[model samples]
Target: MDFSLSGLWHEMGLFARLVVIVMGIMSVTSLLVVGERLLVSFKGMSDSKVFASKLASLLADGPGRLDAAADTKFGKDIGYLGRTLRAGLVAYKGSVHGDKDLCFESVARALERQQARELAVLKRGHGWLATVGSTAPFVGLLGTTMGIITAFEKMAASGSGGLGTVSAGIAEALLTTAFGLLTAIPAVMAFNYLAGWVDARAVDISEASNEFLDLVARRLADGPSEEEEEGEESEAAA
Candidate 1:
């Protein structure tokens, strides 16, 4: 067959095409992962905002916060945080003016549970990102090696191997390696960005929880008061 465009297309070997296909599949998988994680991140931010607001509204005591928050739409996702805050409120209530040990313990435990739940959500998809980042270059390297092998084979066949025989194979081989890296970079970037965002949000949530708890404590504090009539009688007697 003449080495025209159509000839090249028809003659292009299976390995070159296979490399392309593999790269294509990797690209699609990485994109899908990025999309899913982005969606989750956005939804998580929304859920966090809503959870904070609802919990703040009913933060007077454990029972009140629980009664108010447990039935909300974001219930299960943030139930642990709500329960933790409630635990603190309950501990304080049970010993309104008692030692800080029990209240601190209850709140601390609840906060830890809340952190675990949120961390789990954030940890999702990182493994895929890591896999892509680590494996993409190797995929490219394999393609390059295959291409080099083809070039060498063609060289072997022709007693006097020409540049053309090896160039095409080398080009095709390197393309796969390049292709792998192209698919991997974006995935790595997305993973890093999303992971950092999740960490920041977790910190924000922790701080917000502490702030709300203190507010509840402030509202509960009481001071003794004297009557106006008693003050007036004392003044008159003097």
Candidate 2:
């Protein structure tokens, strides 16, 4: 295709317009991902905080009291901590007069399940974000290559093989690279930020679970009074 300078500019301008449109779409997509991830994270955090608080109170009251107390109403928003604590507390109740090792195992399994569920929720948009981040540059490069090739072909046909002849092609190529970066940067950043927060939350859940188990072990071994045990349990859960 023999493209004149004016023709190349017109074509590249249209291509730039397309890049802008894609960038706008990508921006919207990135924001949507951010919003969705934040909603999940905030819900998790809110639930974790409240559930941990309730469990701390229950632990102080005594292992015997956890069964009845765990069932009170938190409605649908009860969150991960509630679900996890309820399962563990129930297991502890069953084993209050049974094998010590078995109770620990049940609670451990419950905690693991909760962690897995939370992790699944966190992972929802990560793949999409990564995909966009990896592919945006290539898309831009594609457009740039097309524009440049068209410009070069035009110059070759005209037999005017000077910088002026190919300038539009180079310009189009540069535009594509720039547009690709514009689309990619935010997607990459959001993926990293959300992933990091999720990892940190997982660590917190682990620490809380470990402390609860240790509290149970201590109360069993020490034969502490209910009041003392309750206080210790709250601190462990806390």
Candidate 3:
């Protein structure tokens, strides 16, 4: 019997073939997920840098600038920071006329909620990657185990204990394990990389959120800006 990959494949039992197919699917899916996540992360980073620059200028003028700037078009697909800030801004605008403490608290809660949501979005495919990484080897091992059993059965049937009788089957079984490892290694690496990115982004989000809250606090302490007072008076007159 032949022992090359094609030969081994031909010699493989149905279960072994199935295991290989499953591993192939896992590898493809993992690659797709990794590619998608990397693209998103990179794009988000770029968008966020631009958004941050704009935000910094607006913030320099005071949080009141956000009231008018809120309606300004950033882009359709802003990054995590943009989305989170937008949420907080909306909350702040809505509650600005209410109690000062409540307004601050409302923005704080909105920022927190937006942070959680952004993290969740970033982690979308992480579970599948983790599952593939942790289980692919075991799945391959199962195929290997079954292949070994078949090899032994063949040896018994042929009434031959010689290595040649079972070597082919053993090799075929081991191929599944190799496939499993191949599928798992990339997944694990991708998962680790993605996790690090997520952690770093989380820190960015936290710091940005805190800075925003401080800005809000300072704006409140200094009293409402003339523009805000004018808006309020206009509303009262109407």
Q: Can you tell me which runs of candidate 3 are displaced by over 4 Å?
A: 234-238
Please give each candidate's TM-score.
0.71, 0.75, 0.95
Model 2 TM-score is 0.75
User: For residues 1-238, could you state the per-residue lDDT of candidate 2 as single tens digits?
Assistant: 3355456447576666586568668768877988988887788789878877766776676544444553455555756666665666666656654566766677678777776786787788898888888989888887777777767887988899888777777777776777789888989998898889878877886787787777666645555457656978999999
Between candidates 1 and 3, which one is better according to TM-score?
A: 3
- Report how far residue 228 has shifted in candidate 2, in Å: 20
- Let me know the TM-score candidate 3 reaches against the reference structure: 0.95
Pick by TM-score: 2 or 3, better one = 3
Per-prediction tally of clashes: 1, 1, 0
Q: Which is the leading candidate under lDDT?
A: 3
Per-residue accuracy of model 3 over 1-238 as CA lDDT, tens digit each: 8888899999999999999999999999999999999999889888888898988887677766766666677776779999998888889888877889999999999999999999999998999999999999999999999989999999999999899999978998899999999999999999999999999999999999999898888867777778779999999999
Better of 1 and 3 by lDDT: 3
Q: lDDT for every model?
A: 0.64, 0.72, 0.90
Query: What lDDT score is found at residue 200 in candidate 3?
Result: 98
Candidate 3, pairs of clashing residues: none
lDDT of 3 at 207: 95
